[model samples]
Target: MARIAVIGAGMGAMAAAARLAVAGHRVVVYERGETYGGAVRRFERDGFSFDTGPGLLTLPAVYRDLFVKTGKQPLEECVDLVQVDPSSRHVFPDGTEVALPNASRAGVVQALEAALGAGVGDRWGDFLVRAREAWDRTRRPLLEEPLWTDWQVLAEREPYPAVPHKRLLRTRRAGTLAEIAAWELRDPRLTALLDSHALAYGLDPRDVPASAAVLPYMEHAFGTWYVRGGIRELARAVYERCVARRVEFVFGAEVTRIVEKDGWAAGLELADGTVTEADHVVAGVDPGRLRGLTKHALDEDGDVFPDASAPSPGRFTVLLALRGAREAEAAHRTVVHTPDRGAELNWVSGEGPGPVRPTVTVLRPDDPALRPDEEHESVVLTATARPKGDWAADGSSKPFVEMMVHEAGAAIPGLRERILWQETRTPGHNGDETGAFCGGMPAPSLAGGKGYFLRPSNSTRLPGLYRVGGWSHPGGGLPHAGMSGALVAGLIVEGPGFRGSQ
Candidate 1:
């Protein structure tokens, strides 16, 4: 049995603990934050709860399967998950609105055509086919492979040259997401709608590879989903599973230095000066955070390490708890776009000031939630990347927050009618909350030109150490991070698996 320690208590970290404990390893998780679910967590702000991280769930089976493997029933955990109908509401600049259905490809396309005009449906179909092919071919191998070595070591030796899925990242990469959309639609309106991945990947859609166009296709194909209470409930469920298996969680404990003994990893040093010895260490923190905190752990060659930080193409956010609400019939699952907008203004940081504009995305409070009637609601809005220089001081400034709220209010009618509670978050705040240096979600933008393998793998710079979470292979998102945890566990269960396991 391996004595394992995970460095964060986020979704990825929780998933790692659940898998490792089930595998019979002695696992301990260290979380610098007071609560778990680092990014996707919730807090009671004025008697109302808000989902801070990813607002919804898609491809939920990825989550169910993890619990099933641990012999636990998912429903037993908090938050019952229900399939959503009419997946989301997508609006265009022309004021045309379309409601996408859940699990119906034809319906979504029909909606798209109605909103964006004709021919767009056919183009969506093409992207869907490609996305299906990518998913079918990609799932089995990498999801099932145990990537346990230090990636930085591999980089030092020449970037461990093995492609995980059959599809090649280099060869399959194609036109930019924006350019691909432009090829299909007429008005730049539709193109802008499709080009929004700029923030998703921390890239400019013009530069992001076309292969990423698969994301929308995947959404249309698989359908959008959510847990009964909130997305963070999933984290709570995973935490429960880990507890059942006796995984030790080191909450509010930060790892300061990694102890390397003669090449292989021996243990780690916590911020409090306590030393813990372990046969293995699976890093669930962002690779940047790990690298920054454990500087002493690097090998001479600097094999497994995080890529340098880069700016995500967009970001701006506002959340509100509605005291007086509406039924919100127009919004079902995902609310793609709304009326509000703030074209890049200036971003002013310590050096003083700079310019950056960001695209904004607003999610209406799902109507069927805990509201006794239609009047109470919860809402969150997120925008594409904006340079840090835009907001004076931090995002906490009343002026900055007010500006964001005003912009959101303008975008969605009646937004100001019932603001029970509210708050705003900036890219800088995100960088501080989670160690995501780029201030994007988990994955970096492929359009920005960072090498594909440049993302750290499950391996560490020193031997016997591995990494997992949004920073590693398979990229970020709930499903991807969970898969990373499983991959890490499987590697420890049996060193990188036997030949036949592949």
Candidate 2:
């Protein structure tokens, strides 16, 4: 059995450990934190609990596959996975509201037409048709398999089949997502709906390629899910699965260095000067921290290098302990569109001040486990924001918190009056929880950005070193990170020629 050292007990790292252990490898994971789950954390106060990380799960098949590969118990047997009906309710700036059905194209189209206008549903339906084309073309390379060596092809090719538009004498096809919104959707509400999907993942709709249509397409195709207790329950199930597989975990043991021997990743050096040698190492860290842990070059020329110091988008969250019970028919998730799109976009991009009325996503799950009783409710509000030190430390978060509460009022009745208590978490809290650079969230890798959107390969320049996480090849999001673990395990177990999970 090979001795493998996995860094960080994040979901990805644990995912890899479980697979490697099941494959007969002696896997040891070193984490600096007191517990597992990385960003998938929970906060509780006064008998109320809240999920501080991702509120919903998309593409749960990824975890289902992980459970099947690593253990006898299926994922469904581990967690109470509930499909969130009317997947989401969107409140447009023009006072229009629409609740889209979960994973049903016909239902979504019908709802859009009913709320937006007569033919607006047809426009969105048409967009989904083209988005599905993009998903089909890139899903295998981007999700089901390891990233290709010639990843530049993914960067150069536009998988989204854009509709041709004639502007006077010149005919052009949409390129960026903003262009798709303007040229094809042709409605401000439709544009806002499209932008919200990208924004939720910390990607800028104006900057992302038109292929990002796959964002909404993913939700529509796979359906949004909620665990009974919280998303952290999913993490607990995975961590328990790892333990059951006999994978060793060393919590509170910070890995200070990636020890190298004969130019290969030999093992790990902890904060206490203890060294554990292994046959291989899997780093589940952001690029910046990975670079700091070793002196060796981890990537080759032309590989995607994410600047750790560069300002990346982070999430501002407000956990509300409300005094009243949740309405019986309330939509689980509601997105309140920003009043000023330009101001909100500029704020997240770090080009302008914070929006007076930022776009806020309000999550009010019906699960009683999060509240003290049926009379009390737990609500979570999140918005994309700049992950800068000053924003967190300069006392600016208070106003932003107020802004979020004000906007969430559109979704929740008497939001401010009903709040019994509130806790605000900034990028600072995220950095503490996940150890991500500046606490910035990483968006999923996309095609057609000159390979700029693609993350580095799982196998590093170092022979025995590999990366597995949101910052690595195939990129971020729960499903993609889980897939990274599979790819890394495949490469280590089956040699460099290993393609990916079948």
Q: Which candidate number has the best TM-score?
A: 2
**Candidate 1: worst 10 consecutive residues by lDDT?**
154-163
For residues 98-135, write the lDDT of model 1, one tens digit per residue.
67688787886787787777887666755566656655
lDDT of each: 0.61, 0.89
Candidate 2 local lDDT, 84-175, one digit each (tens): 99899999888999999999999999999999899999999999999999999999898867788888889899899857566655556677
lDDT of 1 at 449: 28
Q: Model 1 compared with the native: what TM-score?
A: 0.83
Compute each candidate's TM-score over C-alphas.
Answer: 0.83, 0.98
Candidate 1: deviation at residue 459, Å? 1.5
Q: Which stretches of candidate 1 lie over 4 Å from their true place?
A: 75-78, 140-173, 295-306, 311-315, 333-358, 367-374, 387-391, 394-411, 438-440, 444-450, 498-502
